[model samples]
Target chain A: MDSSSLLSRVRVVLCRPSHPGNIGAAARAMKTMGLSRLVLVAPRRFPDAEAAARASGAVDVLERAVVVETLAEALAGTVVSVAFTTRSRTYVQPFRTPEESAREVLQALQAAPDTQAALVFGNETNGLANEEVWQCAFPATIPANPEYSSLNLAAAVQVACYVLARTCEAFSPQAGAIADAPDFVPVSHEAVEGLIAQWLAVLERLDFYDPAAPKRLEARLRRLLARTRLERAELDILRGMLKAVARKIP
Target chain B: MDSSSLLSRVRVVLCRPSHPGNIGAAARAMKTMGLSRLVLVAPRRFPDAEAAARASGAVDVLERAVVVETLAEALAGTVVSVAFTTRSRTYVQPFRTPEESAREVLQALQAAPDTQAALVFGNETNGLANEEVWQCAFPATIPANPEYSSLNLAAAVQVACYVLARTCEAFSPQAGAIADAPDFVPVSHEAVEGLIAQWLAVLERLDFYDPAAPKRLEARLRRLLARTRLERAELDILRGMLKAVARKIP
Candidate 1:
């Protein structure tokens, strides 16, 4: 699916949110990843100062967020519903990384452009209840250290968006310039190694290596050479030098 | 390279942001991925109520965050620095996904674990200044849609840490577990260089260099050994064999 449809058609659902600040922070997170649609399920507080203030520059996202009374209401129109959970459930459900889920979401959207997908986040403390988890199609988990895997609400939103953004191939601090010039690539590693080998031959032939009482000089020299990051043209010029010196010697 | 040292040896720096809440959110994002070191460079407003409120339960992250006057100060002592950008500059640069950059960072750390690496983010609006991007070694760009790619500051941090965490081998949603397991680490570049020098002496004594018409054989040999990624113990064993062989030379 095209980027516009995938981004515009996806919805972020926060179920029974307890905090005004988390709602605001989550709004900011959603906007950063190019997500516009936000659905809140029975939030304790709506349009609160803390939520708006927490959104920072993304106040528009808070203003645009859709408020609903239940998780079912939020999931009503979405073609797919993905829930973020910490615990391993009794009944096994297939869990996919955000990247994989994003692909699936996009593919589903591609097949049905009018339909949408929902990324659901549970309440701060109770998390998504068994009934809430049962409503979602995919159970997703962020791979964090299990000992202290209690990820904050908005941070989870940020990671989910990040993975989605990466999977969908979205934004940059500045990306267009890099995208326009793909041919200007670095010298291949193989070429760099070859040039270094040539230089080594010349140095050794010039009697640079001292067999007896050899100090750390050669290693230091190698390090110095590595620093220059010799390009392809530079490598050719140095290779020419090697040929010249080789002919000059016996 | 182990996951423990890599996370500890990396710093996340946000430079000259206009919002205090973004800084707070960015801090919380870092902690979720097991990253703690945060350095702020000349933010417009800090020690702010909005930032603390946005940080949620991660107030400790804000409490421990380092505020600095310049990006250089934040970058001081870091062995490598990477900058995130959206647009490409006049001269082309090497851009890699956060996953790839993390591996390179880990490899560098394995060579010198005591040293640190820095990932720098630009201000909220201007993104990173061209001069700021120049200060970094790798110019990283997250692929987002060009039409409206303005990502939230903390979301970018989340994506970066998420990619890094995946490469270092998954969760301590708490850390310190991997920090204790430092055995079987990569040998330092200096150590590798020293080993090459010792072997060169051995090869010369063995008449492998052909004293009259020595070619680029030594350089080729060095390049080949460099590819092996000699571990510390491997270097020691090779050095011991070199010494033993050198003693047998007539």
Candidate 2:
């Protein structure tokens, strides 16, 4: 399935959220990761100015958000649900890391074209209730500092959405592809050999290399050049320095 | 070699952040993920109430944050730095996704134990200036929605720190390990066979199965049960349901 279609099928359900600004921030976070579906369950205040203000450019997401009275209604028709929690609950299966949860979420969506998934988050302070957590199919945790695992509501949403986007390839950029890096011309062995020769000649002129007692200095220079992987530009700089010193040698 | 030691070596550099709340929020984000080193370059305001209130429980991170006059000062001792940019700049190599950046950052840290690494963020309105980006060894992009790629400063920090934490295993929880999951007792072949037999018997009593022309129903049911890898508790539930159905039939 296409990333957008799959991502669109995944609902971000916020249960009993107290702050309107967080709701706005969550909307912005979701939209920024190409996730548009938002479900608010029992929000203390909706249509608040703070939410709209915090939402910034994601007003459309807030406008289209589905506000429900309960988590059950928010999660209705979702084939699977993963609850984000910091606490360890024994009833639920092993908690998934965010990356694992993203993979599983995408896998489930791909496994069934019509099936929908829900990423359920709880209140800022109380988090998800045990009963509410039980309603979800999976329990996921964002591994954090043992001393301070409390992530702000919107920040948590951003991390989850970011992981999901990356896992699903919602964005097309390759992780490590330097898309605009200059075209690299591989340095030939001949060029390296010439550069080494020039370097040796310069060192000889500077009395750093002695013809009478060579002492494996040339061999060591060759090894150092090979390890450095000199680029053409870098090689030019070295050559320029060598020529400048050779001029002064006379 | 340890996660905390490696994580501590990473510096979260905010270049000319516009808002103090974002500064505080970034501190909270970093601390939650076990990243404590925060360096601010020319922030509009520091030691502000909004920042403190937003920092919430992560005041220590703020208290210890290093404020510098320039990006160079913030990155002085760092062996390598990655500038976060949303724009496509022709000057830098391909933009790294947060995950890739995290792996590379950790790899660089591991390769040189004494070296430090920086994750640089630009101002809220305009991302990393071209000159600032050029100063860093690597450029990274968050792989956000093309339409709305603007992640608030703290959100970006959260994603980066979260990725780094996960990559370095700063937190002890394994990505997929269910530390608190109940010990799974594997179902034996005999147990599976017994459950299948009981299920067939119950089906026969319910008129759902016929022994005279067993039409592959038992075979299909057996195959289904084998694929399920039913847990002991699940097996017991099935048996109790089957027994209840048989009792009703009588």
Candidate 3:
């Protein structure tokens, strides 16, 4: 479960796969991307000759896959559980993309290095049911053709693996040249709000806010600042500049 | 639409989507990520009441989506077409991860100032079929759990948009604060290849190859050089060194 170790970092969990071919293809896809850990939850048919044949040289992955009866058992020890859902269920929480989910997973891994994480995929027929999605902390969805949004189960695994691999590659330990000198620390939401409030006060003092002038002025300011992604230091500087301007106004 | 005006742009394309709720969720995903453009190709059911209700507040993306019958139509006039696939199709060439694909898309947009570009996703049942994947210039595949790789469609779009947004945010128009004064242009790929070949001849004369050594040596050399991403001036210096070594060998 060590975040630093490549193994035990991520576990791919399929709720219930109907086709053996998908399991095989999923294995192949995982191997191609340098990922091997796989877990199946009550597969309709696994260890089938067809799946083994389709798996190519990834038979090892198939051999090592854990078969469990329920999702709860599969995710028992995992710190983060991300459910893959195609539709937004009435009661299920909203979704994030695999990339965003990966970031979250990475953060969780860093925060609690011993906790394992699982990215769960549902059955082939209906996908992870609403109940399954609700069990997870968040749902991740793949955007597909609105007319025909049916992606093969294995393909979903491939996408998730690709995200993890790329993330690992982009921020590889060897590529940690910037780690020593962190240029900008992200400003917390509270800090950003404080800056905004300060700016608003200055604007109010200068009579900049015209009640009837615009409907979305505050909203626009929020959007603009969100896009900037200012660092804490940068926000502090802006606050100082605003205070200086306020002093001059007197 | 002018691609330049679409700077820091994001286009959300859905292919063969079956559930209307998914379409709505996709719109919500786009809106959350600050992406406005949404395109749909041959959706099974759209503008469904369920989709609008699920969209929460991102109805604008749904209302504005450009619906088309075919993937080709959706990608018309696009300078760069990136197909998001989870399965490795027999027909299409190797795929890049979302990050690499996004980099290419951004680069293509910058290179061809006015050209339109698109990121296409496939159906839910079967991601961009093999033929569809081949139509794209760049193929992006996500990495998932090998055992059960089922990712919800909207999540794929979210990942794509997230990478695009981050790339746009990270891009620095200017090279460095203290731009290196214009120096000798770097040698092109062809020039580098020629220099490497000449260096190989010198090594050959020095008995550096023991019949099987050249292959390994060349691979190591390629890996070392590829890491540098050498500019014109840097390449010139390397070529000059190679030429000097080659002359001395005689």
User: How do these models rank on TM-score, best leading?
Assistant: 2, 1, 3
The candidate that achieves the highest lDDT relative to the unseen native structure: 2
Kindly give the stretch of ten consecutive residues in candidate 2 chain B with the minimal lDDT sum. B175-184
Tens digits of lDDT, candidate 1, A1-250: 4575578788999998999988988887787678889999999999899999878767888999999899999999888878888855564766776777788887787788689999999999888998998999888888764434667788788788878876766654334444423323346768766765665565455555444644654464355445444444435544554454445444
* Model 2 ranges with Cα > 4 A deviation: A174-250, B175-193, B210-237
lDDT of 1 by residue, B6-108 (tens): 7877899999989897887787777767787888999899989989976766788788889999876787666566788775444244566677677766666
For each candidate, the DockQ is 0.22, 0.19, 0.02
| Model 2, position B50: C-alpha lDDT score | 95
Q: Which residue pairs collide, candidate 2?
A: A94-B178, A178-B94, A179-B94
- Taking the tens digit of each residue's C-alpha lDDT, what string does model 3 give over A100-137? 88888877876776677888999877888877887888
**Whole-model lDDT, model 2:** 0.79
The recovered share of true contacts, given per candidate in order, is 0.36, 0.53, 0.00
Task: Tell how far residue A238 is off in model 2, in angstroms.
Answer: 77
Give per-residue lDDT, candidate 3, residue A38.
88
The root-mean-square deviation over C-alpha atoms between each candidate and the true structure, in angstroms, is 10.0, 27.6, 20.9
What is the iRMS for every candidate structure? 10.2, 30.3, 21.7
Ranking by lDDT: 2, 1, 3
